[model samples]
Target: MIDFLTAGLVLGCSAGFSPGPLLMLVISETLTHGTRSGVRVALSPIITDFPIIAATLLLLMNLSGYHGILGGLSLAGGLFVLYTGYHSLTARPVQLDLPKEPPKSLRKGVLTNLLSPHPYLFWITVGAPLLTRSLKVGPAAFVAFIGSFYLCLVGAKIVLALAVGRSRAFMGSRAYLWIMRLLGALLTFFALLLFREGLKLLGVG
Candidate 1:
C-alpha cells in the first residue's frame, strides 16, 4: 500500500514538474490570464483522464494473466520513464516568452490534454498495469494509488500556476532545478525496477 502510494506520488510529481506541453500551457495561461485560468488548466487531467483510465483498465484487465505481454509493456514503460527522467535531469529553466492567447483556460486545457500522447502512453504502459495489480491487492490499494496520483499531479500544476501568476521567477529558480534533478534520479531508480520486473516476467536475465 505504502509502496503504491509512493510510486503514485513520485510519478505524479515527475509528470507535473516535467517539461511538457501541459506544463507550458499551465505557465503560459497563468502568465497571460491569471491564477484562476491556470488552475483551470491544471485541473484538466482530472477531466481528461477518466475515459483513458477506463479504456486502459479494460484492456489490461483482460490480459492480466499474460505475463509475457505484461513483461513487454513493463519494459516499454521503463524506457519511457527513463526518458522522462533524463528530460527532467537536463530540463531547462521555464521560458516565459509565451505568446498571448484568448482566455479559454479550461477549454484549451481539456483539448490539449486530450490531444497529448503522454497521458495515453502513461496509462497504457505504466498506469493501467499498476492499477490492475492494485485491484488484485484490494480496493484500498487501488484508491491509494489513483488518489495520490491525481492529488499530487493536479496539485503540483495548480501550485505552479499560482507561483507563476505571482512571481514568474519561480519557474526559473534554482530550487526548481534541484527538485527536478532529485525527481529524475528517483525516476531512474523506478525505471531499473521496471526493467527487472519485465525481465522476470519474460523469464530472462
Candidate 2:
C-alpha cells in the first residue's frame, strides 16, 4: 500500500514535470491570460483521464483470468517506464515558445489531453494492472494510489504555472534538469518493482 502511494507520487510528479503538449498549453495560457487560466489547463487531466482509466480498468478486469497475458503486459509496462526514465534523465531543457492563438484555456486543455495518446497508452498498459492489483488489496489502497497520483500531478503543474507566471526564465534553469534526473531515478526504481511483480506473476521470479 505504501509502495503504491510512493510509486503514484513519483510517477505523477514525473509526468507533471515532463514536457508535453499539455504543459506547453499551460505555459502559453499562463503567459497570455493568468494563473487561473493555467490552473484550468492543469485540471484538464482530471477531466479527461477518468473515462480513459475506467475503460482501461474495465478491459483489464475482463482479462483477469489470463495471468500470463497480464504478466506480459506488466513486463512491457515496466520496460516502457524504464525507457521513459532513461529518456527523461537525458532530456534537455524545455524551450517554451508561446503560441499567438487566442486563449480558450479550458476547452483547449481538454481537447489537448483527450487527443493525446500518452494518457490512453499509460492507462491501458501501466495504470490498469497496477490499479487492479491495488483494488484487490483494498478500496483504500486504490484510492490512496489515485489520490496521491493526481494530487502530485496537478500540484506540480500548478506550481510550474505559478512559477512561470512570475518569471519566464526559470523553466530553462539547472533546477529543472536536477528535478528531471531525480524523478528519472525514482521512476527507474519503480520500474524495477513492477518488473519483479511481473516476474512473480509469471512464476519465474
Candidate 3:
C-alpha cells in the first residue's frame, strides 16, 4: 500500500513537472491571464480523466482473461516510460513564446488533455494494472493511490504556474535541471519495475 502511494505520488509529480503540451499551456495562460487561469488549466485533468479511467478499467477488466495481452501492454508502457525518462534526462530549458490569442485556459486545457495520447496510453497500460492490484490489497490503498496521484499532479502544476507568474527565471535555473534529472531517474526505475513485471507475466522471468 505504501509502495502504491509512493509510486502514485512520484509518477504524478514527474508527469506534472515534465515539459509537455499541457505544461506549456499552463505556463502560457498564467503568463497571460493570471495564476487563477493557469490553475483552471491545471485542474483540467480532474475533469478529463474520469471517463478515461473508467473506459480503461472497463477494457482491461474485459481482457483480464488474456495474460498475454496484459503482458504486452505492460511492456509497451514500460518502453513508453523509458522514452519519456530519456527525454527528461536530456531536457533543455523551455522557450515560452506566449501566444497572441486571449487565454481560454479552461477550454483549451480540456481539449488538449482529452486529445493527448499520453493520458490514454498511461491509464490503459500502466495505471489500470496498478489500480487493479491496489484494489485487491484494500479500498484505502486504491483511494490513496488515486488521491495522491491527482493531488501531486495538480499541485505541482499549480506551483509551476505560480512560480512562472512571478518570474520566468525558475525555468532556466540549475535547480530545474536537477529536478528534471531526479524525476528522470525515478521514472527510469519505475520503467524497469514495469518491464520486470511484464516479463514475469509473459513467463519469461
Candidate 4:
C-alpha cells in the first residue's frame, strides 16, 4: 500500500507538471481573465477527476474477471503516462494563431482535457488497480490512498499556477531554467517508474 501511494503520487506529479491544452488555456486565462480564472482552472480538475476515478473504478470492478486483460491495460496505461511525461518535458508552447479572448479559450482548454481519452485511459488502467489494491488494506488505508493521490495530483498544479503567476518580480532576471529542467528530470524518472509498475502488472518485473 505504501508503494502504491508513493508510485501514484509520483505519477500524479509527473502528469500535473506537464502543460497541455488545458494548461495552455489556463495560461491564456491568466493573461486575459486574470489570475483568478487560472486558479479556477486548477480547481476544475477536482470537479472532473474524482468522478472519473469513481466511474473508472466501477468499470474495472466489472472487468476484474480477466486478470490478463487487466494487466495488459495496466501496461498500456503505464506506457501512456510515460509518453505524456516525455511530451511534457519536450513540449513546445503552442503558438497563438488566432487573436482571441481568454475566457472562451480557457473554457476550451478545460473542455479539451476533460473530453480527451487520455484521462479515462489512465484511470481505467493504472489508477483503478492501484486504488483497488489499496482498498483491500481496509477503509482507512483507502482514505489515505485517496488523500495521498490528490495531495500530489491537485496540489502540485495549484502550486505551479501560483508560482508562475506570481513570478513577476523575478521574471526575465532568471529564465526559470533550473526549476523547469529539474521538473523535466523528475518527469523522466516518473515515466520510467510507471513503466516499471506496468511491467509488474504483466509479471515482467
Candidate 5:
C-alpha cells in the first residue's frame, strides 16, 4: 500500500510538472483568462484519464498470462519515461501567447487530453500494468494508487495555476526551471527502476 501510494505520488507529480502541451494550455488559459480557467484545465485529466485507463486495462488483461509481453511493455514504458525526463531536463521557458478567442478552459483541456497520444501510451504501457498489480493486492490498494495519483496530478497543476495567476512571469522563472530539472532527475531514477523491473520480468536480471 505504502509503495503504491509513493509510486503514485511520484509519477503524478512528475506528470503534473512535466512540460507538455496540456501544461502549456494551462498556462495559456491562466494568462489569457484567469486562475480559475487554468484550474479547470488542470482538472481535465480527472475527466479524461479514466476512460483511457479502462481501455488499456482491458487490453492488458487479455495478455496478462504472457510474461514476455508484459516485460516488453514495461521496457516500452521505461523508454517513454526516459524520453519524458529528457524533455524535462531540456525544458525551456514557454512563450505564452494568448489565444485570440473566448475562454473554454475545461472544454479545451478535455479535447486536448482526449486527442493526445500521451495518456493512451502511458496507460497502455505503464499505468495499466501497475493497476493490474494493485488489484492483486486489494481494491483498497488500487484505490490508494489511483487516488493519490490524481490528487497530486491535479493538485500540482492547481498550484501552478495559482502561482501563474499571482505572477505572470512565473512560467519562465528560474525557480520553475530548477523545479522541473529536479523532477527530471527523479523521473530518470524511476525510469531506471522500470528498466530493472522489466529485466526481472524477462528473467534476465
Candidate 6:
C-alpha cells in the first residue's frame, strides 16, 4: 500500500509535468484570455476522465478473457503516442491575439478534451496501471491516492498558469515552439519504447 501510494504520486506528478498540447492550451489561454481561462483548461482533464475511465474499465473486463488484447491495446497506444508526437513536433506555436470579448463558456476546454484521443490513450496505457493495480489499498487509501493525484495535477497547472502570466515574454511563441518540439521528441521516445514492448507481447515486430 505504501509503495502503491508513492508510485501513484510520482506517476501523477510526472504526467502533470509534461508540457503537452494541454499545457500549451493553458498557457495560451492564460496569456490571451485570463487566469480563469487557464483554470478551466486545467480542469478539463477531470471532465474528460469520465468516459475514458469507463472505457478503460470496459476494456479491462472484456480483455480479461483474452491473452492478446493487452498487446493490441499497447500497440494502439503506441500509435497514438507516435501520432501526437508528430503533431507536437510539426504543430505551430499558438500566438494569442487576445480576443476583445472573452469566451463566456467553457466549451473550448471541454470540447478539446473530449474530442482528443490523447487522454484516452494515455490513461489506457499509463494511468490505469497505477490505479487498478492497487488491490491491497482500502477505499480510504484509494481516495487518498486520488486526492494526491489531483492535488499534484492541479497544482502543476496553477503554477504553470502563474509562470506564464509572470513571464509572458519568455513563454512567447519562440520558446513555446522549442518546448513543444522537445516534448514531441520525448513523446516519440515513449512511443518507440511502448511499441517495442507491445511487439514483444504479440511475438511480432
Please, what are the lDDT tens digits per residue for candidate 6 over residues 49-159? 767877776667556545376667667767876776777678574454444446542566677678776677677875553355343355666566667767767676777
Which candidate do you rate higher for lDDT, 2 or 4?
2
**What lDDT would candidate 1 get against the real structure?**
0.91
lDDT of 1 by residue, 1-205 (tens): 2278988999999988887899899999998888999999999999999999999999999998899999999999999999999988998888776878899999999999999999999999889988988999999889989999999899999989988888999988998899999999999998888898889889995
Instruction: State the lDDT of candidate 5 residue by residue for 1-205, as single tens digits.
Output: 2268877887898889877789889988998899999999999999999988988888888888888999899899899888888888888886777776699999999999999888888898878888988988999889988998899889989989999999988888998898889888877888888888888889998
Task: Give me the candidate number with maximum TM-score.
Answer: 1
Between candidates 2 and 6, the lDDT winner: 2
Better of 5 and 6 by lDDT: 5
lDDT of 3 at 113: 96
Clashing pairs in 2: none
Query: How does model 6 fare in lDDT?
Result: 0.65
lDDT of candidate 2 over 22-84, digit per residue (tens): 988899899888889999999999999999999999999999989898989989889888988
Tell how far residue 199 is off in model 2, in angstroms: 1.5
- State which candidate has the highest lDDT: 1
For candidate 5, list the clashing residue pairs, or say none: none
Instruction: Show the colliding residue pairs in model 3.
Output: none
Per-model root-mean-square deviation over C-alphas: 1.3, 1.2, 1.4, 3.6, 1.5, 4.9
Q: What's the best-to-worst order under lDDT?
A: 1, 2, 3, 5, 6, 4
Candidate 1 deviant stretches above 4 angstroms:
none
lDDT (Cα, tens digit) per residue for candidate 3, span 3-35: 789879878988899999899999989988999
lDDT of 2 at 19: 85
Backbone clash count for every predicted candidate, in the order shown: 0, 0, 0, 0, 0, 0
TM-score rank order: 1, 2, 3, 5, 4, 6
- The candidate with the higher TM-score, 2 or 4, is 2
For all candidates in order, the CA lDDT equals: 0.91, 0.88, 0.87, 0.63, 0.87, 0.65
Q: Give the clashing pairs for model 1.
A: none
Model 6 alpha-carbon miss at residue 121, Å:
4.2
